[model samples]
Target: MQVRSLVSFLALAARLMLLGGLLLGGLAALAEDRPWLTAEERAWIAQQRVLRVASTPSYGPFTFVDAEGRLRGLSVDYVSRLNELSGLRLEFVAPEPFARNMEALRAGELDLLMSLRETPERAEFMGFTRPYVSVPVVLLRRVGSERQALMPGEPVSVGQGFAAADFLRQRYPDNPQQVETDDKSMLRRLASGEIDAAVMDLASATFQIRGEGIGNLRVQGDVGYAYELGIGYRRELALLGRILDKTLARIDAAERQAMVDRWISLQAERSPWQRRLLLAAAAALALVLLGLGLVLLWNRALQRQVVARTEQLRIELAERQRLQAADHARALAEAANQAKTEFMSQASHELRTPLNAVLGFAQLLGGDAQHPLDALQRERVGHIDAAARHLLILIEDMMTLSRIESGSLAVTPLPLQAGPLLRRCVELARPAAASAGIELRLDEAPLPLAQADPVRLEQVLHNLLSNAIKYNRPGGWVQVRAWAEPARGLLIQVADNGLGLSAEQLAQLFQPFNRLGRSEQQGTGIGLVISKQLMERMGGQIRVESQAGQGSRFILELQTS
Candidate 1:
């Protein structure tokens, strides 16, 4: 009886252990699926067990309802994937018009929105995930419409709740906009000549025209705005936003591409004649493949001869590579000579204006006794002085740039105090800043010593300060700050609320003599180039951050001493 009891106890223990193992495995699988989700996020998800998601009903290819009254599109597929990956209950609300859906989202009647661009107005009430898809906004017009281009006075229809409507209102305000219910209505109006042109995303426009059999409309041109679509949720549901973003990220590139291909495929309806043509084409392709196979078999027979010829060609290839290297060196030399010639031409042109002013003013000054000096003559003398100083500065910048390019410029890095150097630079620029009605502020906090060439660093700082002052708007401010980074480096930033640069301008920022379309500004344009080289020589680096019409910041990083 005791032996029997022992066997039963062993069986019970084994079953308990098995049950515990299964429980642990289930928990491990859950963690693996949602590694980024924090305990707080999981708790929040538990509380909000169901998320009501909606998309525009007429935005085809992205999100739309089919004739069978089912939500189907790329966005629907994305939501389905999100649901599967996140293990969240995403219930779809009934399909509604775009404006009503937006209102529903705003009224807290909906929990999530799919495939919509996040505009500033929407951002006030909702938060957005990173864009998963981007499509260009295109203008559509009827085929052979008299409207060649979107005119200022022409009426352009855009979807009422679409981001393109807000974009058009802001960017092309002169063009009168008629807000339609959706892309379908807008396109229909465009086809019937009620609207001159309509703005919508490429996917929706193409889908509507082909699916609706509206053959009269054609894509006119891009509207310079793209719809970067993403999921948007209520602003207060910050945890939900994180959950959505993490889940979206879990959907890999291949899966996202598959979803896009499933929805955005363009297919042409083939008539009987076209079907016959396709059959003939398929037969021809089969014949071509057979010929290719025969050719491969023939090539196999001559493999040995081909190998010998390949070896000979390899020897010729090596010779060609050597000659190519020589040619590349010659090309570089010619480029350098061309650069020098262009520099000289620009320098001479720059020098002539100031030199002419100086000479002309000096000649007037020399004859001042005959004219008897007046207030205007005195002011002219000051102009002469200013012209001469500008000429001297231009010459110095040119010489410094030449020395840098020739590798003759010396940079001696040594321990130096950053605070005093920054303050001195700001003080030197204060007068210019004041004259330009710009406020210059320097951070007075203690800063660590940095390893940099003092003279070269000062030169770079002066150039940056001058630019901040010169290009600043009236009543703008320039802020200078220096701080020690955790990486044992000192970062000095000269930021200005001035006329900022575009991406194209920033690309050519370091190129010598590229004024970046600011020809009206007084600059030799080589100061930044010289500064970049000088910083590199001193074991440092310089970089800029800018957005057009916003502002610019120039940062210099040096090793902490």
Candidate 2:
């Protein structure tokens, strides 16, 4: 009987081990299926099997109720995936306006809110999951209008509860807001010109513009704000927040992209004719770009040609101007020469005739045999003759100077003996030196033959001798010397021990009609000027050396044969 009891115990032990193994296998499978949930989370979810979620009633593409009252949108699709992945039942509450839904969530009437932008104020009562959807906010305006920013005092419509509305309120507070119930209302107002512009999310605006057949509106630009949408639940439901966050993270990138493309692609919403129009526009743009490239190349070549031609024209203009200026200068010189010639001819005719007649009558009176006169009367006749002769000499000198300046005076330079020429000039100037009581001396040194016009050289030497004698004090001496230079050819010097010039007087010495304040002297002031010009015409130069209270030395240099 004891042996029978032992066999029964062994059978019971085998059955108990099999039952325990089966129970442990079932629990392991359950843990594998819901690895993201903790034991406490699972119990919490089991207690609250269905959670009520609500979103903006008319927000399209993200969350909306269809015309058939079916809950459908990007957020609904996400919740469907969440339920599939997490085994959590997230039931949709009846669609309501966003403000009402927000109030419901705050009042703890709703378990969760979909497509919400978490804010600090909202977070006080709610817990949020990581964002699952993002969309840019955009501006809407009439098709032809061009407003880039909100203007003060301008009415800009925005959806009442959208994050973009708050953004606009803070960013452009001076701009008045025409708060509308939703994006649809704001867009309608923008389309009808009741508001200047409207701000809303891009997806909803695009969906509504097409759905409502609002053809007069266009997306002006982005408003620099985007909606980072996520789920919001009561702050106490931390377990629910974690469950939702895990579910969101598990909805991989590929699945999220497919859902987004299905709703947000404008091409999917476009008609067949619109697609055809787009293709045609693409081809036209390609052709225009090709033509523009060709035009740019041709324009560059044309610009190079223009620049080359402009530079050429500039050079030609400068050359022509230079030639014109030269011709003008030459013409002016010729006119001045002609004027001088005419004046000299008139002066010779007008003054020389009277002076010659006066000299002739005076000479006739001085030698007349029929009129025997006293010594006083004879002296008076002598004075008249001297005055007339002086006037004649002055007139002749003026004529000679004018002829030399006008190039009418001919000069014929040749190799000439200097010694004979010097002796003859000295003899001619001796009587004047005697009258002034000045001694005129000539050096006996042998001189080289010099290149000069004979008559012009003689005239220059005679003028120098006359000036030396006339300006000298009593007992002063004048000296003439000549020598040959191996490099300089020939040099003749006429020096004077007389009233020497100061530094200031030397500066004005050669200027015509400037007498260096010696106006009382019997000289025309143009003699030195004429002599200097004549020497230059003969390929020679004349220079002076003098110091005040010392003496004056004048030197003439000429080239030799």
Candidate 3:
């Protein structure tokens, strides 16, 4: 009877403790739930119909919670703007990975996704709004890295992945390419000069430039391009779609751009507490030296103050920086990976276009018993063979680009003078210039010396001179010049009276496979791509000036000795 009474007493005490804690917690929760809603917010939420929005987090500078735990950035801002404009009440929800998000929308658990890449494949599953932002998939590479090759030419490379593979299949199906999945393996290869370039998003490239301490890697132009980003929703949500379309359209282009600039800038700001923690650390070290003074000063009550101060200072600061850095890194890595996948796809398409024809004719010649070629047929076969060889060069170039990316090939150095090499390039290209009735002339003297592989230098000159001649009108003139000046590296130039470029075309000129109206000429569209890579490797720079229909001038600068 005594033992049972004791157990019952203990159980009753435990129940009272739980009841007392629950009552106190309820009061605290009530205090925290007080909402300071603005007149606009109250009006908006009052009309709330519970419009659920499922979006992927870590979609940085797009739809992410800020340091203060408020959802902000381009997409978030756009959506909030949308809510204000349309007076639609929204309930933000976590995005289910892959098809689950779409499935939720179908089940009416969600109204829409803030943004999704527009593609024909996705059209069946969802309705898309017209795109407001154009984000091209660009090559993010170490600035000094070589350009990727498309064919059998011995050249530097770009890394490959899903985007690159799809690009290859769509653009260059007949060409051969090597793909990579491991990241450390890719960078190690690139560092060794095996692969030449890596694909990455334009925005993420900036973070990489800062983080990797790579002064050279930069974002090239849109290679294969990317799917348009649009608001995605269930096709049945026609009423909601109509409301969003009107609201989204109100954001406009300039406003959208301003949002992007502001968010990216805000992302660069470090938490103020981070700096405070550093100061507190220094203060603690100073206090550590005054042992006797601190001991008496730090009673149990003083000890509580010290712990609270340090907690707010170093420990929390360290934790926040660690999380922020990790988030920033993940965002960029995902961007680079997407770029790599896109590059592979673009390279594939470019390779296959020529190979399809080459293979078609080679098979004809192989059908010996079925239908042998006569003299005319043999002549045609010869033409096809020549064309196939040219196509083969393109494939080799892409393979080499992969190898350069993978770090399997090595460069053989050659020494030579600068002035004479320019003259040789002029002489070699003179035939083509004459055929088109264009004059090719050497630039004036006062040329400086340069240390480089003579053959590589010649290749650069040849590309510039050829472009100047080919792109020019009949009776136009191409001038080749090389000069050295104090404080600047060796200056080499090729100017031409040609159909010039607008600002946009000039921006994209050196990107691989971007033909830029030179497609009519018998070329793989990688001449300048190769030239740019080789020049950079030799520690040189290539720049161009052009006005539409006025003419174009290409300037090459190399490091002086």
Candidate 4:
């Protein structure tokens, strides 16, 4: 009674101690916003956020450096939103001119830069943000400047204007022009009858002419396509880049549309003919007919090509069907062979189990215990058990190989703690390691939950460890390690100091009955083959890295859940 009371007291004390520890742990966790990250995570973040950003002024009302030099713009707001979602901080720095901004980005003084026209040359060093705004480029003019415009029937000057420049360069090729300065100056020049009208971005002209108090300016007929703006980042922050991509996709579509409307609606007066540019049916009908003829001819040629491709596809499909039939036949043959092999293997193990028991009793019953033993009789009985044990091992290997190859092997995946799995594998292979006079060591860290079929994963680990031990030299060592790579997933490797494999042997390592050791070693060599198949079934893989005399390491990769 006294001993029972003492034990009860100890148990109560232990429960109270556990409860106290749990309370402390919970409080600590609740205090942290992002406690999931460790010191290593801080290092990773440092390596990733390696750049300051630069931007141009008046590029849009969206992006500009204010007098105090803090960044503010449409591009700025979008990037700020991006940072909020990604949890990665960036330094936004704006120095000066667009050319200087680009120079800073190229020289690595900044991590990213924004609000510049995209060119093939820029794509070489940077990645672009998702296009958030597309605006038309145009030149607004008063009602009287059409006939007096210089270069009227000459060629358009492009290379400097935005969308209109791009369109005229491609569409009319006859006339193009741009004002290097502000549209108001061009408007003054036009009001005073110097040049015809100013070529500027459509939004700029609208803001200059009406929103900012200049008069007598209105958009010409529909200018062209949209001049889309996108942010630019360096090429190396791929994960962060991908995160931004997903975040951008999640932003409300209406919100993006509102931003466009808010910025552009603050700025334009529609020209009278803007709504009627395509309203002339007689003129448009003639152009439509010409376009239709070309479209029909191109469509007719496309149909011919499609028909030829369809026929080629038909022939290729027939060839594929033939190959499929051949593959099916081969699969059936393999299944049948595997069935036979498994039956023989299991039968041998079962049959020899009883035979071994019988042979043991017979030898004991016929021994020199009761009377003088006949050496020949004892020897015969010993031979029966000796042969049976050897046969049993071979049978076991063949059964494993057969079931695995036939795809009848079951694989059940769960999130497993990595450290315990390695320990278990080492424990299972301990006897073999002892027999070889080799040391088996496991190097493990706190790893993530591995998505794996525990039984099959353990089987592969055990087989590798067993092989390592079985083929190793005396006093040799076998090491097993588990590591996690955020990018590459999980790695579990088993290495050995042993008689290593040749290139030819390595190539055939995962083939059934392929033994790398001499005839002296005890392996049917189906373990690796079975291991490979089972690993694949679980969406894991096994690969061997080896040198002829130095030894071999077999790496197993698993997805971390």
Candidate 5:
């Protein structure tokens, strides 16, 4: 009996010692005069009478109202701790909805809001505290969903004013969304099967499923983004934000973690049977790992053997494929060449027969001395002849394009007099310019001989001259200039004072059949294309420059001898 009394007395002494130490520690903490606060901050807090803080208790664990209708949650707990530590009086107002809270904060009815996302639009009226918490956004689906990913067409639900709503809209704008007033409403809709999916922060989803026991919904995956929560205050209260930041920085990591643990337990409680199943699964995994080691060693040796055999087969298969591919490519080339040759032959015959007839009859009538045709009759014949000649030129241009595409167009360059040839082209185009009431001006300086195919050079010059006259206004001017560059080569430019091209039109200027909105003009659309190709084949370059209201300039660069 004496030994038992001694043991009880020892236990009682231990309890008394622990209680005394805790009391002393509490008293010491309370005795701190200006702990973790600077003198300026203390003075500011003294002058600042009472800060009206507005918060919503609808968001559990973060902020929420209790049964007594008091604002209490993670944010509330922090407010209380901060007030006690700093000797600042913060008055908590009635619980308000999130939208109302923002409105009140903006209207100066409340000094600050507890926690909200910082967005660019909100920055216009309010300043934000440093991020205190980050909540990952998650994709929640029905429990038995087999989908590997969220489709853009699926119906989704998101909190109306959540930052995740903007993220979702950018990610899947085409998807239909049902915007709920809050996260709870979103989850309720998801549980009722009204929406296929809902995007919300992981913290709220966990509280709904684990804390509230809403078991029908499950988190499929994260939305790959997160919201950073912070204190929001009016822009006028910038100094207050700085003070809050300084105070929050003073809170130690251990105390902050303790506060978090006091509010949330992420891991849900498991039943006894479920705990046993988890243990059995762990044991099964351990046994499987043991057998897997032996199988891996055996598989490594067998894989080496199979790889050696596969090398020989792979080489043989590659050689056979290479030979077959070569033969198939050769056959395709032959077929394409034969088809092109046939097409060109048929096109040439079919187009020239009617053109030959029109040219033949018109020439005969225009030149006939027995009929002695009048001036008007002669002019009519001239129109027919010009039309027929234009048709013949179109056919030739098409044939040239085909040859150029097939790599069959040959360029035989010879020394040619640049000055005389350019002069002749200007002279030939003068009649067309005069008919169109456009002034054709030639500025020809003595230029060195150019190394180019004479026929192709003539074609390029004629097309540029004709296009200048055709697209010019009634009284515009076309200037033809030829000059020799010291080291670059000879340059020919055709500038027109007519409607110019835009940057977009200039980009596609040489594309085949791109008429540049001049479909009413009488010519094949491939003239510029043929011109560009002909210049390239003869080892020359062609380029153009134009502005919207000003006219266009086509520059052709040729090699000089």
Candidate 6:
């Protein structure tokens, strides 16, 4: 008997041990399913004795205190679940006049706010949680009202501190007296016809109608956009943000859906009398909607017909007017072109006659060696010759420009030694450099032969050299450098230690008649313009680089043989 009792006792102990193991395994699984806060996070969370949260219990279904003086609403319930999970003591505080909640938050009297929309103004002092709920903003008005649309000067109402108010303010900037009130008060006033219409979120409007028996009001239409509700905390509470975000992430999605469904069920339920009234109202609304739709279709048809007729008439009139106007404009343009061509031709001939006579007489007087004069008379004669020559050069330039514009300027391309051509140009410019007390340097490296018209190339070199000497400050230096590059072939740069051009001046440098605000320089403003065209004619390009107060570098690139 003792041996049997011992075996039975051992089996009983084994059974109890097996039962305890299963319980332990189930507890471990449950713990793994729920997330735990880190040790440091829990320590940080524990430092807060109590978190003072602000709630304006006036907006029901979203947030409000029941008649029993118990805070019971969607936001309240949601925060309670968050509090239970986070292990923080949340003390709910209510401030009168609702808007003071924001003031308390700004003043640091409130640590958190429930169900608030994020805005630029609020974001200044508060950090927001991820949006937990979203609802459409809408316009509501009394049922059976004849007012289908808001009349001018009729006052509208919007929820205070809400995006709908700002949207309306922007949409109707001319109307400044739009009433600002809470959603509940606005709905109450709307039902009593104190305002033409009120703006609120769809959920709140529905809750007011079903939960509070605000059955007199019906939705007119949506306001601009939906409002997304989120929890707002003071910006100083960064740890709070992290903690709340983590806790919110761990919340079951179904649990949140259940919360939403609970509130929706409460907001959707109606009494029997209310349902009957709604059914009757819905029937009437359907007829009104059908009538309005038919009227809209008819009006659209008539409007389209009128628009088609007006468009046809307008097209015919426009075609007739356009033909007449085009004919008149063509005649005027032809007349203007002829006048311009005639003026240029006659003016060039008339001016060249006097210029030639002056040059001829000046050369004769200066070169009369048989009737030699004194030094003063010689100098005076030289001056006359110089002025006449300058005038003759100006005439030649004008004529060349005329030919260029008329597309008659000829170009003859041939291979030429770039070294000798450039040397000759530098020699010709030496006298001017000496007169200006400027130093001229030349790079005598063996340069590749270039494909260009010798005469046109020489002309281009002369213009570059002259401009370099003319613009260089007295006692400054001018350097002529040449190099060779593949494809581009040969490059010659005329760099001067003279006043350079600014970015703004460089932009207009090549435009005819633009001297870039240079009144002191003697320039017709077309020298660079003509030079650019000539270089292109010879299959070359010329560009300049400069900076203020430094110097200028003009690079000429040409194809070589």
What's each prediction's clash count?
Answer: 0, 0, 58, 9, 2, 0
How does each model score on TM-score?
0.50, 0.44, 0.38, 0.39, 0.43, 0.42
Top model by TM-score, which number? 1
Candidate number that wins on lDDT, 1 or 3:
1
How well is each residue in 316-385 modelled by candidate 3, as lDDT tens digits? 8999999999999999997675456335434653465458667776766956767777888878777877
| Runs off by more than 4 Å, candidate 5 | 1-32, 35-39, 272-561
Q: Give me candidate 4's TM-score against the actual structure.
A: 0.39
Q: Between prediction 3 and prediction 6, which has the larger TM-score?
A: 6
- Provide the global lDDT of candidate 5 against the true structure: 0.78
- The order by descending lDDT is 2, 1, 5, 6, 4, 3
Question: Which residue ranges in model 3 land beyond 4 Å of their true spot?
Answer: 1-379, 403-415, 444-446, 517-522
Tens digits of per-residue lDDT, candidate 4, 408-500, equal 333545456667668877887888788779998888887887777655677778778878887789999999998999975789989987988
In the range 414-512, model 5's lDDT, one tens digit per residue, is 456677668878999999999999999999898787777665788899999998899889999999998988777999999998888999999889888
Q: State residue 511's C-alpha deviation in candidate 2, in Å.
A: 90
| Residue pairs of candidate 2 with colliding backbone atoms | none
Per residue, candidate 2 scores C-alpha lDDT tens digits across 1-561 of: 899999999999999999978865664555458865777766555445578888666788878778887878888888888888876789898889988888888888899987788776787899877666666676778988866455667777888766777788776788778778888887887888888788887778888888788989876555446676789899988878877775665665467778887777544357899989999999999999999999999999888865357788899999999999999999999877666665674456458757867988888888889987689999999999888887787787787776566444545455577777788889889998988899999995776667776667888999988888877899999999998989988898999988889999999988987888987886778889999999998899999999886779999999997
Candidate no. 2 TM-score: 0.44
Tens-digit lDDT string for candidate 1 (35-120): 56777666555445578998677889977888998888888888888877776778888888878988998999998888888887
- Full candidate order by TM-score, most accurate first: 1, 2, 5, 6, 4, 3
Whole-model lDDT values for every prediction = 0.79, 0.79, 0.61, 0.64, 0.78, 0.75
Q: In model 4, which regions exceed 4 Å deviation?
A: 1-387
- lDDT (Cα, 0-100) at 509 in candidate 3: 87
